[model samples]
Target: MADEVVSRSYCCFVCRNYVAEHDDIVSKSFQAHTGRAYLFSHAVNIVTGPKEDRHLLTGLHTVADVSCSDCGETLGWKYLKAYEPSQKYKEGKVVLEKYKIVKDFC
Candidate 1:
């Protein structure tokens, strides 16, 4: 018999739609309008809203709201563009509020 590995991921709190993989998390120290959030390198099953410039804690960034494709719940936002040179790494990344998702194992 061989040992099987379990994969961990995050799902939408409202509908349990798989949103992000555990391995894709880039930072856990992020803050959102509600509270703590996480930065992810990749996200799935989400719909991105319009892009608008917002002054974040780091700097001004062009961001779009991300919602669950299944339930249309506002999950978080996607970084479309970061104005600060040092914040450029965040562009194309996604931030999901800690309270908006639940841990899922498969």
Candidate 2:
């Protein structure tokens, strides 16, 4: 089971406490509608922000507006989109993957 985990979740480039395990990631290293890279997480520690139609692929998705649960630093965003029969898997998912995150330590 340990080999299946490709990464570990942490605070936004500050705190080292574990937030979410990589095992729950729906999509890893995936490209977003903004032409940027992101990881679709099943779990995260973030507060909801204003919903907007920023990206075309995600529709009018709300931002998670997440900061570090331990420290106040911009962590990531959870895309809250309207549920669809074909896209039900991405309804309550998060996007927080940049150099600022902890991917692997060993």
Candidate 3:
């Protein structure tokens, strides 16, 4: 027999805030709800502070609050660092193409 495995799509916990994922959270408040994990379409290093400059491209392992642009779905998170040299920091949103999903995440 051939090897068989199934990997489902997952969204960021932040983006999924106001969508169907939100309802899942509400329903399974106490229990671990792993039903609606979304497949992120992009990968942005989750950095804080300014939106410019070149820093270490260290990605986050956990989904630390990422909200989707469309329908407000929480996609996967990118581990990012704060844009130092300034406190008024802007968050980084990882951009991913539709096809890149397989190459990047998968």
Candidate 4:
């Protein structure tokens, strides 16, 4: 059987960059957070591929790891993808799956 692809949006818990391309984390086996994990990104968008599909967009865009940079908190990710939803995206809270972190930066 194949994995099911989910659709959702992501907003940086801390930053002006609201929408991003990739938000959902691929492969649940991939480790992302040890303690309380947060979500953050540089851009936002809607994708139809799997969470492993990281290269949905192009250009110098692709925030591999997202950190607080201030307090050094391992946030979520910040990658490049399609534009986020406009006023229409306004809805209830959307839960997104976390991604796997191959490395980290402090």
TM-scores for the candidates:
0.97, 0.61, 0.23, 0.24
Off by over 4 Å in 1: none
**9-99 per-residue lDDT for model 4 (tens digits):** 4443444223433443332332233433223322233222222224322222223444433333344444333234441221221222243
Candidates, ranked, lDDT: 1, 2, 4, 3
Per residue, candidate 3 scores C-alpha lDDT tens digits across 40-104 of 22333222222333333322222244445544443333323344444212233232222212211
lDDT of each residue in 1-106, candidate 2, tens digit only: 4666345544456765454566666666565444454655554555556666445364544445556666756656666664445655666777665545665442
Which residue runs of candidate 4 sit more than 4 Å off their true CA positions?
1-7, 19-25, 33-106
Error of 1 at 40 (Å): 0.4
lDDT per residue (tens digit) for residues 1-106 in model 1: 9999999999999999999999999999999999999999989999999999999999899999999999999999999999999999999999999999999999
lDDT of 3 at 42: 37
RMSD of each: 0.7, 4.4, 13.2, 14.4
Per-model lDDT:
0.97, 0.57, 0.30, 0.33
Q: What's the number of clashes in each of the models?
A: 0, 0, 23, 8
In candidate 2, stretches whose alpha carbon ends up further than 4 angstroms from where it belongs are 1-11, 32-36, 56-60, 83-86, 104-106
Worst 10 residues of 2 by lDDT: 53-62
Candidate 2: residue 23 lDDT (0-100): 68
| Model 2 TM-score (2 dp) | 0.61
Q: What pairs collide in candidate 4?
A: 19-43, 19-44, 20-43, 20-44, 20-45, 21-81, 25-98, 25-99
